[model samples]
Target chain A: MEFEVDEELLDIFVTEASDSLEQWEAISLNLKKNYSADDLNKLFKIAHSLKGTSKSMGFTQLGDFIHKVEDLIAWVIRQDREITASESQFLLTTHGIMKKWLTGLQLNGNTPDVSEVLWTIGEYLKGEIENLDQLNTSNNMQASEAHAATETSQRTGIEFLKVRSDRLDSLIQIIGELSIHQSIITHSLNNNDVQSNNFKLAVHQAAKMTKEIQNESLALRMTEVRGLFQRLERTANDVAESLQKFIEVTITGADQELDRSVVEAIQDPLVHIVRNLVDHGIENEEIRVAEGKSARGQIQFVAIADAGGILLKLCDDGKGLDSEKILEKARQKGLIKDGTELSENEIHKLIFLPEFSTSEQVTEISGRGIGMQVVKDTIAQIGGTINIVSKKGEGSEFHINLPASLNMIDAVVMELQGNKYSIPLQELVEIVDLNNSKLEDTEESHPLLNWRGSLVPLHYLSNELILNQDYAVQREEGSLPQAAMIIKSNDNLLGFGVDRIVGHQRIIVKSINGEHENNDTLKGATILGDGKPSLILSLSDLSDRLKSNHRMEAV
Target chain B: MSEAILQTSEQLENDKYLVFRVGTSYYGISLSEIVEVTEKLDTVPTPNTPDHVIGVVNLRGEVITVVDTRHLLGQEKSESHLNFVIVVNTDKGKVAALVDQMIDVRQINKEIIEESTSSIQSEANSHLLGIAKAEDRLIYILRFKDFIQEALSRLNGER
Candidate 1:
């Protein structure tokens, strides 16, 4: 028998299958929270669609797999039984297999072997589910393998939707105020003003609806951090096995939603840090047993939202940082002078210096501290900060703090010579009242401020940008340029003078063409709420420009 | 037989052009090449670019580069601000040519269009093809692709 398919049809199948499987993967994560009728229906519809598309396109095997999944979903919904954790994981693994098989089919008409997956689903369908104990053991052995094969390893950079979270937050905040006003009006009208609580209740009801709509829209732009955690888990397993060690990664807060661009930027650094844990942080089984601990090493990978940022804590119960060795290495590298008393935190931070490595011997599994500098550089590049806390013989924890979203950042809007400009909120260290701050060289030399114990440079943006000012009108003499936006770039702190601080708003940035992109001062331009182009400034670019200018003057 | 017939019809209509004036000088580009003509846009100047580049304008939510056609032709800059932007399609993407006004469209025969010598003093002459007539008024027919290529090269080189 001969079955034929055209190239165009195959292309459509691959694209459609990839999208469905990706959606299935995200839903499989959500089903962990609470199973709703809508989710079940969505799952069933997706499976049925895949089955129909594949079968009609003459892909018998792929269609058969999807058909089996559809049957399982239909059965689960009919029975109304709570989906076991193992069942959900199995469903996710099936999506992985289908997606990979699609990739294979595209390359050469080869299909994946899903008999193992089918058998597992069959057991659940027949109500002869595998015991939890058996599933746990199997999970320990297979969790790492399946995750590596599935989404993360082969996944493209997560899609970045250029939108403003600040704008969304403002909308959310406005609706909140409207509801509050309704409550106030309700109290007055019921007693003295009019005579109706219905108006108040209705306003409250409208607010609730808007709130739900806001949450749903926000959810569209965010994905669970669990997908990233799984990639790290896979790295741990591969590296641990290669080093002949046993390591298990347990993750909590896997449901934290994150911006795709933040996830993309942190993926490589997270991999490096996890590989370091397996190769250096976790002790060998024999050593663990001798130390009165379990033979298998344990790693707790946690993700949580904390204080306006995403916090990732990677901890391993293994041999902690050897301070003696690190101190010696630091001294040898001339990072610190002899007999210099430094705090434990400062000593640990020395590992991030250029070319600093404590790994005596390098192997295939990434050497610890070898690319710690790279990890540090990358984290800094993404507007993130890293901290290391460790105690000898106990364990080590690396805490990384990253902004909530990358594409849309909160910006402080400033009024400069009647033009609106914005500076990123994260880059601002403080805003100084120039009248209170002491001026160092106001008249003759370069302008510097006596900031606390050190001198900080002051750059007038108007002077730097050489903006033409036609101040045809005069101001009152005492109306000094009082406010300044102080930002820290590299190790230098500088102040930019603005006429007025207009307040903060979330902005979506659009790129400027050729020369402006390479220009040191301007980051990009964003259209204002009033439909005018406003420039977003970069302090790092300003600092670099200042330093170069200062160097040229000295020469 | 059908292929020969199609070629004949295409050649007959190929000389049809849309005539527009950038300054006092009148010019014509192929009718098929213009994408749109828009009222003066609120353009934002990009710092440190070539002098001929007026700026970029947000045209119906899409940003397109705007060029000062008078300066590109090495003629006197327009005394009065020219507000109309003639949006044209090119291999390099869409760009707007600043012009004082849009004149008219006419079909010209090949015989009446006299080819110009390449030795004209202005650099833009290399891109201007020949002189033709539309209702007794002379229209300067242009090979716009050459002009577009020159514009793209300047954009890249300046960067």
Candidate 2:
């Protein structure tokens, strides 16, 4: 009888198999250092489930292959053996082959040839491959080749994410409704002129609960960074092995929680950074010894929740980023003019520029001239910033700050001609009271305000925003703006004048659909505490607009 | 019997349109395109948007852009308050249109609807699918997808 594979069932099996394989790989990597019975049982369970599911889904070859792996794991568990380095390496190689087969299955419902892997496992089961040295000589070359193929194919396939439960989604929805209802209650109370202290206290307490629920619901989307750090550790090890270098990698804050989407988006850039550290950033043994440093290079990855975002610091104790070499490269590439004096920090930043590579010879690892620029762009795409700090002959540290959640941000609510608008608090350097500052009207169309002994261009919020005629008329008759929000845009200070600073609050940002999406002045829209929709201002875009307007005026 | 069956199948294809007034003109959008008809919600004016987009409004928890139908149809901006917002599902998302009044939904026959002629085809009226003759009034059936795409293109042009 010919067997027919159910596409839907096969897809489920594939997703389940991929997840199990990831768990197996992570556990095997961990078992290299610390071997525990519980972890071994987890491997066994994962392998058994994968085997059963693959068989049921008509992937018998894959099932039989995993069955052999399961037996190998069972043997280790039965012997109560401490996983030596060689055994752990063997498990990891098995994982690599399984992952490649899974990717092939996902791309096109076919698994690859697994006879070689099965033969190696057969030898191990038959006691021919007993020790570390023999397994290494037999499998290392094939394993590295398989790893390369898996990496490329995995990049081309669709990434499967862990499915979130419907209950979490409903909870978030209910929290949204609760917040809206709370605002309605507040609005009604204010409108009815209820001045009773007890009633006010009750409403205030309800509001507080609503805010807490909103925060907790948002937290449901967060996941720990441990998985991401493990992948990075794997990448570091692989790069170090390929380079034939000895390195020590230290990681902290593995339990730091970030939005799942943020974690997924950051994985590639972090991996690239890790590879660069292992490849170009760290020096080899001879150079390190000659520099009076330890022979083994050290790389540290630290993550901490700072302010309202995650701060990731990747530091490498190696021949630090040589600004002179970077400057020379920048000059050779005509990226900078001759005799242009740049500070050491500025010179180090030149590496992030596109097509900037200081490597004398291009290696397979990094110097094809596309790594750092893409890293910077990816980080910036996720509302994050990356900065480099290096001291000559000391080390280089990359500081990346990313928002805790993409949709929620702390914004300072302000009024422009009775219409409420919000500016992300992170963008504002300081809020200056225009009433206290001196305004100078120059030949320029916009006014300049004196801020901290320097003249900063001041833009009236009403004039800059595309307001209706009524607001424009009101602005013409109203008094001068009372506040100026000083923002640093492109390293220059610009002040935006508004009617008044209402207050600061955490707001859930919702994208404005249709025509307004393309409006650069508005980042997005958010519902305020009063259940009113307010526009969130994009300060950087606004600055760029103002700058262009000035240029046009000059023309 | 065959003629009767043919008539019934054609009638099945006929759709009910929700008619609304902008200035003196009445426009009909198929019911499938509409999400809800709501009372005019408060809109916060967005800067740098096209003139037809009055602003965005908070509908339930979602913020939807509100387009002024009068301006979109090349009529003078409404002086009085728009009493109704017809929220429609567009390719972009849910967008609400400000109208002077909400007329009754009517099931218009496909046979009586006249395809828009090239003589009436201008940039403003390009989104009109056809004109339906119902009782004593002519309702311009709006191709909502095209209407939204045109509005978005106009916004892009302004930018």
What TM-scores do the predictions have?
Answer: 0.64, 0.83
Candidate 1 lDDT:
0.71
Error of 2 at A268 (Å): 2.6
Global lDDT of each candidate: 0.71, 0.78
In the range A1-555, model 2's lDDT, one tens digit per residue, is 025666566556666776777788788877865788888899889889889887877778988889998998898888987867667766776777677676666556556677766787788788887654454445544554554565555566554555347647667676676666566667768778467664576577667767677776777778778777877777676667667777777889988878987887787788778778888888889999999988888988889999989999888887778888888888888999998999887888898888777677877666544578899978876678899998877878999999989889999999887778999998999999887779999887689998889999888877777765532336557588889999998679998899989999888889887766456667788998788899998787788888898799879
- Model 1 chain A weakest lDDT span, ten residues long: A466-475
Per-residue lDDT over A1-555 for candidate 1, one digit per residue giving the tens place of the 0 to 100 score? 016577677666676677677678667656744666678789899999889988888788878888888997888788887776656655655655676677666655666576766676677667687532343333333443444443353364232244457757766776776677677767766777544565556666667766565454655577678778866765675566457788767889998868776787788788888888778889989899999977888988998898677899999988878888899999988889998997787778888888777788786567544488889767766668888998888888999998776656678887665666778887898887887888777663448877777787777655555432221123345555657878887656888777778788877666553234345456666777667666677766667777788799989
| Maximum-DockQ candidate | 2
Each candidate's interface RMSD, rounded to one decimal? 4.9, 1.9
Off by over 4 Å in 2: A1-19, A33-42, A56-58, A71-87, A96-113, A119-205, A289-292, A360-364, A367-371, A467-473, A515-521, A548-555, B1-14, B79-83, B124-127, B153-158
Q: How many residue pairs clash in each candidate?
A: 0, 0
Residue pairs of candidate 2 with colliding backbone atoms: none
Error of 2 at A531 (Å): 2.4
Model 1 CA lDDT for position A228? 83
Residue-pair clashes, model 1: 0
